[model samples]
Target: MHIKQATPALKAVAALLLTAALSSCGQSQNAGMPAAGPASVGVITLQPQDTVITRELPARISAFTVAEIRPQVGGIIQKRLFTEGSNVKAGQVLYQINPDTYQAAYQTAQASLAKAEATLTSADLKAKRYSQLVEIKAISSQDNDDARAALLQARADVATAKAAVETARINLAYTRITAPVSGRIGKSSVTAGALVTANQTTALATVQQLSTAYVDMTQSSTDLLRLRRDFAKGALQNQSGKAKVKLILEDGSEYAQPGELEFSDITVDSGTGMVTLRATFANPTGELLPGMFVRARLEQGVRHNALLVPQPAVSRNQKGEAVVMVVDRDNKVHARTIKTSQTIGDKWLVDGGLQGGERIVVEGLMKVQDGATVKPEPLKSNASAAK
Candidate 1:
């Protein structure tokens, strides 16, 4: 029985030795397979700077000046003097009216003026002779007085005739319809031989000045108020009280010319709760047309010490907040939640959570996790462009 108990003890010791040998062999195999190093990740260092924030609003283009052509006198239109859609200068005659009646009236007034002048000359001679006779006691004082009165009446008649002549001359000149402003004229509403009256309700043609254009942008009153409030709080400085504007065409292309803010309407549209803001732009090529739809982007404010991160480094979390993987000074990876205000190109403008002088991973994101050590490398190309 003692020999059997010793044999069982020997078997137990052999089993324990086998287990130790297996563990040692497994550890040796793991060591020979090569231990994995830290994950390789591409990182970018962020710096703070003053960044301009722009707001885009829908806008419509309008001409700088608009002129409506109308006749100043009553007459039959003799001819249309200008080609439709042609540029016209101020004071340029655009239409010809029948001036025969006005010419006749002018001539009649001139004849009346000449006859009155001749009568005045005769009366003057008679008055002078009567004055001499009266002085020599060769004629009664009442006769001289009557002669002087007749001369005065003749002079008054001449003055009245001169005024009538001037009136007729002005009326004759008005027969020619002229342009009130220099601009491109639209199609004529009245054709040749069309009758027009003085101060007619209908316009003969429309002229629009297109060398410079106006961009009228409509923005919500609430947004405008918020911008004003931000401005007042020193968040934005309206440099020189004029902000620069950028134009975007309907096809999603930016306009070559830049513009400046002109004014903001004080009254809001009751129906839309929106305020109109005007911007002036150079339209030398006439590319901007009146009533054309467009978009205007203008600097709303400047954010000081703002951090911008490359979009590659940013990801969305389960809570829908923007998250980025930040590599700390220890080279350890950590997920960061940051607030973003807007996207400037391919970078996100960080509003909060993350700050300047922090490093964030931009590449090799799949190889990293929270609490994992990483091999950090600078992000290529994007750093120079972002700056």
Candidate 2:
């Protein structure tokens, strides 16, 4: 009975020893292998670059020059010379007023001048004859003086008549109306036989130069100040040292040609607190018309050391702050809030909270959280390939 019990104990001890050895072997095997870690994620490293700052503003297309056609002299329109809505050259005749009355007045003034000249001639002969008579005692000294005074009066009358003739001539020439400027003329306000007054309040027609166009835009005073501040701090540099502008048509198409920024209003509008800015563009095809609504993309300046973060990497937190998942030096992920100023293409212009060379998690964001170690894979950019 003792031997049987002893054999059972020995078997139990052997079984225990076998189980312990197997456990130790399994632990050693696992120890030799690597432990599982956090998952991998796609990331992009931040880089500082030079970027241009541009803004689009509401604008209006206008003519480079506008002239209102008005009559300088009052007259009845005899005939319309130029076709309505046609291009006109400077000093081109556009209307013909009836010159009948003016012609008659001119002739009358000429007759008056002739009559005054005849009288002057008679006075001259009488004055000479009277002076000769006085010298020989043929007439009194008083008679010679009277004759000289008549001659002076006659000369004055001739001068006055000559001036009247010139006035009449000018009035006759004014009967024909001409274009004051070279441009596309609008429709005529009055047809032939219609009477018009001199310098009337209503214009007879309008002309606009369409070869070059002006784009008028309004910007807030605050924005203007900010740009000035940037310039003062040297944060922005002008590549061409010129504020270049571009036009966007009403149909959402960009203008083929670029433009130059010309003028800015010194005074801000009190009603809207907006400053008016003007830009000029070449419109050889007459595509830009007066009063047409458009938009202007103004290149403010170029900024250096600009940090751009891809838009896919940005997310808004519960507090409505823009945040991103940043990977640290030790491969640990951290949630960081970033300040973004504007958007450049498909990226956010990172203004604060991140530096160049820092990596941001772009993919597998949902797979990892703060303090989790990750395998970061560099993101391949399509734009780089295109470049």
Candidate 3:
């Protein structure tokens, strides 16, 4: 019986020793795992210089000056002097009206003016002789007064004739239809034989000043208010008050010259809830035409001390907030929530949650979990990451 009890005690001691040995082995394996350190994230250094924030806006081309040419005098179109769809300068003759009748009227007025001047000279001589005779009692005072009145009447007649001559001259000059503005002229509405009236509703042609063009765009009032607030808070600045604009044509080709903002509508449109904005660009080549659809990018403001990060480094949490994996000094990975504002270029602008010089994960994020120990490795360039 004593031998049987010793055998059972020895078995119990062996079992305890085996259990402790297994536990020690497990602890040793855990200790051999490498501790996590700074992750190999694609990082861009924070910049303090001015960075422009641009907004792509849809717009249309417009003319700075447009006019509908009309006739100023009533007459038949004698000749069409210019080719249709040609550039015209101000005061350039465009059409010629028959001036035979107007010329005759002018000559008649000039003859009447000459006759009246002769009558005035004779009346003046008669009035002077009559005045001398009245002083010598050789003529009556009433007769002398009549002679003076005749001279004044002749002078009045000459003045009337002169006015008539001026009127005729103006009518004669009106026979030539000239361009009131310098621009590109459209096709003529009336041909050489067609009769046109003074101030007619139908235009003779259309002229549009395309040397300098206008680009019309719209912006929401809410956006403008937000931008203004940010500007007042020193968060944004229009380093270029009239920031340069870039045009994207319908065919996707960029315009050669840059434009500048010219005007912004004061009142907002109640129907669309947007305010109209205009930009001016020099179109020396006439490539940009009126009513052409276009896309314009306007630089709103520049941000100083901006932090931009790669989009892959940012992830969404359960709350739908953006989060990034940061490696702490203790060589452990920790998930951090960040606040983001807008996007500049291809990266996101981080408003909060990241300090400079902190390493975030750009790769191997799926292989590890929170607080997991890892061996940090350099990120290899791949097609999935930003170029």
Candidate 4:
């Protein structure tokens, strides 16, 4: 019985020793193996290229020409000859006031003019006869002088009568109100038989030329100064022959036709501190209406060598400073602060804080920390990825 117990204890000790030796071997094997390598990140190499810069500004649509139709003379409106919201030609009759009174006045002035002319004829004949009589000593020199003065008075009276007739004719024409400009007419404020006054404050109708439209945009004085400085420094070039502009409607639809920058105000607005810019666009389809809100995309200038980085590669810190992760030659991650001027598509135009040939991390930013080792991978082009 003693031998049997001793054999069982020996077997247990041998099994425990084997388990310890295996555990030690496994620990040595793990220790000898190297740790995992650094994490891999996608990066893009920065390059300088010529780029065109455009600025989008809020703008307001205005008519090329606006005219308010008002009565030149007071009278009862006899008829409204135009349909509301219709295109009208210049000098097109729009309204017909009661012309009965004007016509009668014109006729009366005409009769007065005829009577004055008849009197002048008689005066001229009498003056000539008196001159002949004076020469023959049949009439006194005083009589001839009196006849000549009468003729001059008759001529003056005829001139006054002619002016009255012309005035009456002009008044009669005013009764037929006509469009002063060729454009689209708005709603009429008066109807037939409606009483109107001369030079009334209220307009009978409005006409706006819509064939071509004006887009009035504003830019801050500071920005204008900056742009001028850049131009003076030769940092930007206007490759486009003229200042070209494009429009975006209130509904976010782009206008089919482009526009030209007509002019910019020389003086800044005191109230807003902005300079007004006007662009003219063709509106053959009449899509752009007066007072419509729009946005104008104007090509400001071209930068010869501009550095741009993908927007996704840049991140803002607690202080709201733009920062990016750059992989150095040693494959070490670095946090670099950058100043971005504007966004162009999916990229940001870098104004400072970066140089050419630097590797900017675009992917796997969360996996790596600053100053840590990273495995750099070239970012695939979007076109290649799409394929």
Alpha carbon lDDT of each predicted model: 0.90, 0.90, 0.83, 0.92
lDDT by residue for model 4 (1-387), tens: 899879989999999999999999999999999999999999888877888888899999999999999999999998899999999999999999899999999999999999999999999999999999999999999999999999999999999999999999999999999999999999988888799999999999999999999999999999999999989999888775778999988888899999999999999999999999999999999999999999999989999778888888899999999999989999999999999988876789889999988888889999998999999989777322111
Order of the predicted models by TM-score, top scorer first: 4, 2, 1, 3
Error of 2 at 287 (Å): 0.6
Q: Which 10 residues in a row give candidate 1 its minimum summed lDDT?
A: 378-387
TM-score (C-alpha) between model 2 and the true structure: 0.81
Error of 1 at 248 (Å): 1.7
Stretches of model 4 off by over 4 angstroms after superposition: 1-34, 382-387
Which candidate comes out best when scored by TM-score?
4
> Over all chains combined, what TM-score does candidate 3 have?
0.74
User: In candidate 2, residue 243 scores what lDDT?
Assistant: 89
Give the TM-score (vs. native) of candidate 1.
0.76
lDDT of 4: 0.92
Please give the RMSD to the true structure for each candidate, in Å. 7.0, 7.9, 8.1, 4.2
For model 1, state the Cα shift of residue 101 in Å: 1.8
TM-score of every candidate relative to the true structure: 0.76, 0.81, 0.74, 0.88
Per residue, candidate 2 scores C-alpha lDDT tens digits across 1-387 of 889879988999999999999999999999999978778998888777888888889999999999998887888898899988899999999888888988999999999999999999999999999989999999999999999999999999999999999999998988888888899999989998899988899998998999999999999999999999988999899767568999989999999989999989999999999999999999998999999999899989988988888887899999999999999989999999999988766788877999988888988999999889999988787234111
> What stretches of model 1 exceed 4 Å from their correct place?
1-41, 115-160, 240-242, 300-302, 311-321, 331-337, 363-376
Give the C-alpha miss distance for residue 4 in model 1, angstroms: 39
Backbone clash pairs in model 2 (N, Cα, C under 3 Å; residues 3+ apart or in different chains), count: 0
Kindly state the number of residue pairs that clash in model 3.
0
